[model samples]
Target: MTPADPARRRLLLAGACLAAWPLAASAARAPQRVRDSRALMGTRLDVAAQGPDAEALQRAIDAAFARMTALSALMSHYAPASQVSAIGLAAGLQPVEVAPELMQVLHMARDVARRTDGAFDPTVGALGLWHFDAPQSSIPTASEIRRRISSVDWRHLVLDERRQTAYLTERGMRLDLGGIAKLSILQSGLDTLQAHGVGTALVNGGGDVVACSQRGDAPWRVGIRDPRAPQRLLATLEVRSGFVASSGDYERFFVQDGRRWHHVLDPRTGRPTEGVRGITLVADSLEAVNGLGTAGMVLGARAGRELLRRGEGVEALIASADGGLWMTDRLRARLVPVAG
Candidate 1:
């Protein structure tokens, strides 16, 4: 035998002992494919899983979806009775006690805001002056924007670690977790799946994606949509175990006088961010990827590259406003270009 074979084999065996089960044994048990889909977090949630028992996997999927639904109730921006809504309703009056899960999200949102230096601020909710939705598509007068924009500041959101509460310092301040919460909610669903003994799975909410383990002989395949082309994919990724989060200016925007007014607004200006049009971040953990895409869009391609370099395991594909495409070296090597 080779000198390192025994040690390598021992290490692999140890890994199996620590894990839930060995991948080979899982496949040996004759795993079946299970999939389900539904609307979640204001987008479609598509989940596919693999396990030995179809019935067990299906039940696990349902539980996972249920967990996502529960988490969504905590973060929804439009839900009047949501916990976040309560925080906004009590702004300047009192700190609202929130669930631990919500507290975790708030902590994450604030952390991202701090790290990005307001490039992707959740407080941009205060600039809720533009409506990209049909029948209500409109923008506010410059005077109105200037007034509300003053209240848009992430530092204004206070999280009380001792009391597990959230408070907004300004009377009309709002907290929109749209940039950060969907991935967490999807992650909650994936956690539920693993807790239920299903390990090989993929869950995608609109564009944010997370997948684990292996599917037969190959890893999970995900298509990265082109920001410039709605019908074409720029590339496809083969993920082993990772989180994917994407942000785009084209998703909800209106063109006026040759200017694109998108929902992803810059907190500093109360207007859509300029320079980068879209960003897709892939990382080993949700924490590494969440909010990064939006931050990259605001920071532009160069600064965004600097931001990605700060993270240990993050890779990205950035489509700039000037129609130039940039991809991290690691991703570029593995990224398969879609044939035209």
Candidate 2:
């Protein structure tokens, strides 16, 4: 009467342990990370996140990409319904009301143009007559370029901040925010990740990347690609809560008769700048470094270095056409050069 049967006790103990197994597993499961990329706005927007629940992580990543897509629709010049297109259509006719976000971006573009003395003008969209994506890319004729150059002045892009309206004072005047819009979209993706409560994450909009928090104990590593050799890496950077953006002549160009014609144009001449082959900028805030990458190439190595120094926490690395290299001392410390 006092002793229990051994086989029965063993069976009961096994059942109790089985019931507790699921609870133990739930408590012990560590957060898993997910990484994904979506092609949007002619470039890939990449997202990576870590969360205790896999489904939550996936949802956060999707939300981040959705944010990027929505911003692209608002700012893209290709989208017929985009605010940028609306502004272009109203050129010389009247002021077009735009969303506050578009107004902010337009203001930033104008600021960059003034800072670089029109080197990074958004009104260079007047030269949008040249198409690199055509069936056969070709350079514009001198006469055609001259005709359009008359409308390429940034001063013509009048932004009324109080009204949140933009006006292109010339009939053929156009606006393109290809420079800073992408970076701003990347930042928006990061904000989405944070809104979803995803702490450790990375949002890489093609060449521009913003990393938040740390991956485990180490910071995220980003590769700076060689402008001449897209397949090779020029340097690697380790960062936590930092933004890295690059601009390169190789990004969009066609070679003709041993001459390279790229898309990053100089507003004054209606031609691409030939000073630097590529420029990469690292900064604490994405907005702070927005448009500076291309501005660096147009600003040249000397002015480029000076432009970066003016910022609170900004550094740059520039590769010149003459096979020369220039980098800020702070960036040099954080950069690990790739070996030949």
Clashes of 2: 0
Listed in order, each prediction's TM-score against the native is 0.89, 0.87
The alpha-carbon lDDT assigned to residue 71 of candidate 1 equals 86
CA RMSD per model (angstroms): 7.9, 11.7
Cα-based RMSD of candidate 2: 11.7
Candidate 2: which stretches are off by over 4 Å?
A: 1-29, 214-217
Q: In angstroms, how far off is 198's CA in candidate 1?
A: 0.6
Instruction: Give all candidates' CA lDDT scores.
Output: 0.79, 0.76
Q: For every model in order, what is the number of clashing pairs?
A: 0, 0
Q: How high is the lDDT of residue 128 in model 1?
A: 74
lDDT of 2 by residue, 189-261 (tens): 8899999987777777657877777344235667777765666667777767778888888766788899888
lDDT tens digits, residue span 1-340, model 1: 2335342122101100101111333234555767687877766777777777899999999999999998898888779899999998898999999999999999999999999998888877777778977778798999999999988889999999999999999899988899999889888888899898887887877678887875453466677877766456677777778787878876677787887788888788887788887888889898899888888888888999899889878998888888898888998998777688
